[model samples]
Target: MTLRLVIFDVDGTLVDSQADILASMEAAFAEIGRPAPARTEVLGVVGLSLPGAIARLAGDESDDRLARMVEAYKTSYARLRHQNGAASSPLYDGIRPLLEALHARDDLLLGIATGKSRRGLEALLDTLDLRRFFVTAQCADDHPSKPHPSMLLTCLAETGIDAGRAVMIGDTSFDIDMARAARIRSVGVTWGYHPAPHLSGADRVVEDTAALGRVLDDLLELAT
Candidate 1:
């Protein structure tokens, strides 16, 4: 069997950063003297790149205003991280075990495809001491926002894994659609911002991280 590459989205999938993300978003809007987007609205765009997500949240704001909000978001998010120290977003239950189990498998390769900037992604991975698990990492800095296949294709390229042998695991439709566009499989996780119904585009939807390994086992079998 060819090595199966599993690409994961970072924010809602691996780390439960919803609270911090929401706080930063609200702070950004406040900085611009604009009412913050509703929580559900913000959550809906969790998988998009910062600029794309901000553009959506800004609605009719001018380009300059949107840019300012983006900068504010970055500043606020960084400050929040600094304040929280190591107590930021906690890794989802079973994530470490899942990664270790997968890493133990010679037939599998792990990678990350996230809307997070490279700096943010690296900081989170390093803080969690998880930087060694992934063989490839793709970020918003390297590709277009989610729902585009660029990130997945880039991960496949970097890992020398064909789309047929790859699977994307995330919590949003953007992740599933990206995999679909790339002609690969996707597994949706339910414990994130988006509910399972919203993740119907995924090839399979698992209820939690504990079920992820089983789902991947099934995907790997089908891929071969």
Candidate 2:
């Protein structure tokens, strides 16, 4: 049995965090005394690090304002999580089962590569009782934002998995591009924030968890 590492993106991939994300973005802009970007605009940057996402959304703002907005967003997100608990960012349908099934495979190792800060990711995994599913987790705090390949490369290194034996599964172009840069295969999921068309670069594009499972089996050569 060959060892394989499967890395996942968090927001919009494993979990449906659009509501909280948009709410936090709105709060961040409000705290900076600026109007929030449109809903589409906010969702468009879901896979980027907070600072990078905010910078893109508020490109004209100074670095100070961007930093302030980032802090505000973090505060607001924490508050929302406290208020709504796990419901604030529920796992997408079939994700838990898919993860469990994958985790059961002795030859496979699960990991995370997300734009979330380490603290944020930890809190989320704890709240959702999902920390045990992953062997190694990579976050925005330790690397450059997605599309840079830093996170994926780190995940590969930490797991001691070769790029050819690993696959990145995510919902955004950033995820696919990052995997490409890292010389790894990728699966783009359509049920998340990015439209399916945007995922054309991925080696495989899946419409649902069922399709994703099939694709993963094929990509990783897992026994059915």
Candidate 3:
């Protein structure tokens, strides 16, 4: 079989996490006696790693303040996750079916490349019952933030899939840019935090999970 890999972005792609993320960000800012960023500002930094994202939201805050904010954000998010239980950050519509269909295929390998930490990713996968579907998982804990290509490059290496035979599916410019930087094809979804214009750099832009499934099938067929 030709080795083909499909890498997914976690937050805005597979899961609708904006509410949890925004709530936690607000709590984090409150903890430090700082004003909370608006929803648009929070959404803008969704695809980057927590520290980097928090730093951007912090503006001119000192490095120590940024670090404290990051920690507070993590703590707030953890509390939210614990409180939400099974309903935490529900998967987007059609995501489960899409994963099931892809997992059923023999020729394609599945993986995740995200700004989420390994622990955080593991919890998400477990919560969504998605852990068994992925063969390789690369997280911010192991790589530089998105648009740097480290996570995607590591996924390609670990999965033994050449960049030419892989595609990254995501909802943000960071995801598309990361794929581009890694020399792989990228497919963008419109349902993510970023706007469609921001994702124009992607090789293909899709509207929803059903469209996403078709794009994935087409990419693999072309790869083969």
Best by lDDT: 2
Compared with the true structure, all predictions reach lDDT values of 0.90, 0.93, 0.89
lDDT of 2 by residue, 1-224 (tens): 67999999999999998999999999999987989999988989999999999999998898888889999999999999899999988999999999999999999999999999998899999999999999899999999998999998888888888999999999999999999999999999999999999999999999999999999989987322
Q: Give the TM-score of each candidate.
A: 0.97, 0.97, 0.97
Model 1 residue 56 CA deviation in Å: 0.5
* Candidate 3 ranges with C-alpha deviation above 4 Å: none
Q: What is the lDDT of residue 45 in candidate 3?
A: 94
lDDT of 3 by residue, 13-44 (tens): 99988888998899878877988999989999
Q: Candidate 1: what lDDT? A: 0.90
TM-score for candidate 1: 0.97
Candidate 1: list runs displaced more than 4 Å. Answer: none
Per-residue accuracy of model 1 over 66-178 as CA lDDT, tens digit each = 88989899998888877885567788989999999999999999999999999888888888899999999999998999899999999998988899999999999899999
Which stretches of model 2 miss by more than 4 angstroms? 222-224
Show the colliding residue pairs in model 2: none
